[model samples]
Target chain A: MPVMDKLKAVSGTAAIVGVAESDQIGRTPDKGPLELHAEAGRNALADAGIDKSEVDGVFTAGYSTYDVAEYLGITPHFTDSTSVGGSSFVIHIAHAIAAIQAGYCEVALITHGQTGRSDRARAGGNPGLPSAQYEVPYGIIGPPVAYSLAANRYMHQYGEDRTREAMANIAVSTRKWANMNEKAFFYDTPMSFDEYHDSRWISWPFHLPDCCLVTDAGAAIVITSAERAKSTRKGAVSILGAAEGHDHGILHQMPDLTRTWGRHSGPQALEMAGVTHDDLDLAMIYDSFTYTVLATLESLGFCGPGDGPDFVADQRTAPGGDFPLNTSGGGLSYTHPGMYGIFTVVEAVRQLRGETGQRQLDDCKLAMAHGTGGLLSSTGTVILGRD
Target chain B: MADGYNKPIPIPQPESDNYWEGTKAGELRLRHCDDCNQAYFYPRNICPECGNNNTSWIVASGNAKIHTFAIVHRPPHPGFMDDIPYVPAIVELEEGPKMATQIVNVEADPSKISIDMAVKVVFESITDEISLPKFEPA
Candidate 1:
């Protein structure tokens, strides 16, 4: 189906009823992944003014206490534990919509939490599937190296000087946004584009600033039908559109290093949301790496490929800029406890409700949130609006 | 089960059986779609572009370009602890398709690595049955 039609179908049918987040500012050495999940789940239920036992559907990505149904101690009529990299939560939202539309459940809860700070050893261990015993010996390790390769390719395709400077500008702009968000990890420590240029490289074409911060925390949200949402505790943030797409799981399978499935899925999402880029007041793009955000911006038609660096360099994405992106500082400065996709949904809801003090946009009507997973392998886009 | 080596053992599904066998034989293999005339890796049952199941495996020349890479000063896995500051790279194979592999015999310095630098594959024997493909400055 065409993107716009797909979007219109979901319009006003389902709304995010409540959004809540655990403390994301600092390390939480006392918590484990499951504990945070439960806390966030409870908080979201409270925000929705719904009974804890009323949630009949549970969805989660990344680390959880146990099976989502078991961890939350709810017998969900529908359950999804889809973990397709970091964007899993966004994908779950789309799944939840299908479940709700099908009458499988009246209310669903999506949650995520991680004690990435406490589990330093596991955090530092070779970052790959634990079951893949054959590939690790050859030294296919963590996410940084995997994404670095793509960043390197992007620099080669674009001019080296321009690519480096553009990415630094992305960091600088995101950090500037972070400065306004007290919850962001780097709220006080701001860096300039030039400083980003001079910072030591974690991988070729990527500075320290280009990488996201490893954080420990949890975030959760409650979703239901628009009618059910209105009768609940908080005002509903209606879901205009949601879509997910996959290119390939392994990096070796991707068609190109620079372009990704986002090229296809992003448009599909906007078309489904029945809105154009001009209609969007803010965008909360996943920022596992600075390049991912830049890449998605171009792929989603905000700009053309290789134009992301320059598009960001002119302050188009900064606070008060025409395109205010990552107002919560994104994963670059916010809590990136493993998979941070759920937080994007939370921030989008807060923005739509005009709940974000200081960081909120004037008369913000529409928003776009994107999540990426598995070596730039998959993309999930959710378009939200205020009724 | 070695302390520093967590080699990924292949549990071959029908689609990827040949690719795993090829890795065991130290030959990098990829699938060529008969309809689209395009090559792809991480072998799939259906051709991504043409949706043709009539695809065949072909040996790669092992020549590629450094699409991108990163130097890990901190090893996240205990298996990688000894290899602190190792180079993990994505190499775009000459045949098309990018592979995640390590770049050997190169400085881990960011300035030394350039995008699209020529690279060639080198096999590293992890265990008796597995010989993983890596890359070096070619």
Candidate 2:
């Protein structure tokens, strides 16, 4: 899914025909990552109305490609375990589409599951090489601290109130959507700017509401050649366009503090899909932190740099608003489970299929699913379409 | 400096041995590429810019500016509980490369750490083998 400027634009040849999540989300110590993967994988196969034997390709993040294959008892001709943090699954969709177009595989199944909270399997930070020498010495660090550096810089660049208000709105608004999702972990828990502002600071400029929930969850998406999707009884969500790129593996080395590879992949993907920001009916952005959403909204061209505050004001991304984002509650309130990239796509596909019961967007034609991994380190964008 | 530093310290790579050695001698050492004449941190043998093997260590002037920072209120590791609410900052060396280091010698106040504030390097000997280079207001 690495889209160099020289590569050809991605033609929409693959469609995600099925998407599913495990029966449980918040806590599942009874299920490990592999068990969660199998549960979601089998359910996704059923959702696609296809048999397990028909799958020719398999993809997942943070695990050996053979684990899912061996567990599900299928021999796939193609498999990818490209672990670039959370965005791996989004990148997998692009790779699966390319593989299908190249006839490397016929049907691709992508799976992700983690017991981040239940098993305490979450990594504090990258150890051994770079982060150890540079980042860790300062203190025990994690994504929140690294992300906070960017958010703190953003506040220094813009008006403090504006950026703070913007960050608060992102957390509050996402919770508003979570209020509509019965499955959301934060269901019935509404957030306001006052609560957000008063919340205890984890990292300066970040509060309890600012950070994503650490929960256990699993998700899967099944994609096939667009032509094959046309014959399925389920309405398919085509991969309109997709692109992936990395700016830096380490946060301090990020080229721009306020931007990410999203600044590039977002445009490359939209150009490939032949769509614009105005064309998107829904946006399922990875929200590990409130600042993450603000930075991404700017980088994805939804708003200008340092303009995220104005763009998110007055609850624009909340329910019954002009832009409906993270309708599945997102990682902020729904489920994070370490790598959240797949869940973003899962929600996008579900929304496009009109499977989101009460929080579903009306007449959703096109939606964008974007994921950020490793502190704005890797970014991937996938635009899905119903038509 | 404290004895028996019980933290996850960096194990010097053969490529970066010079950096750790230099830290022991109270110097901030970084790699320089002879091909492109660019200096960089986290010492590596090969020049990342020109892909040239003609790289060597050079002592840094220790002058820098705060690029950005965050005060970590929650300790992600048990080793850092005593140092909770620490300020971790990214600093820009006068020579152009940036690094991740803690901003010491001042209160870890959010309003105090303005971006681009002038800073200088100071060393804290973690163990007998390693002394970390931390930044403080110049």
DockQ of each: 0.43, 0.72
Regions more than 4 Å wrong, model 1: A1-7, A23-25, A63-66, A123-135, B1-40, B43-59, B76-85, B92-98, B108-116, B126-129
Residue A214 lDDT, candidate 2, scale 0-100? 90
Task: State the lDDT of candidate 1 residue by residue for A294-346, as single tens digits.
Answer: 77788778888888877887777888787788888888877687788888888
Q: What are the C-alpha RMSDs, in order, of all predicted structures?
A: 3.6, 1.9
In the range B1-138, model 1's lDDT, one tens digit per residue, is 233456344455566667667877878888888778889755776887777798888899999997777677655455676776888776789998766778889887778876679999887766565566789999
Per-residue CA lDDT of model 2 for A145-230, tens digit only, reads 89999888888888788998888878988998888888889998888778888889898878978999998888898999988988
Error of 1 at A283 (Å): 0.6
Each prediction's TM-score versus the true structure: 0.87, 0.97
The candidate scoring highest on TM-score is 2
Worst 10 residues of 2 chain A by lDDT: A1-10
Query: Runs in model 2 with CA error above 4 Å?
Result: A1-10, A121-128
In candidate 2, what are the lDDT values of residues B1-138, reduced to their tens digit? 376566678778777678889888999998998888989866787777788899877899999999999888887777778887888889999988999998998888877778889999998888878899999999
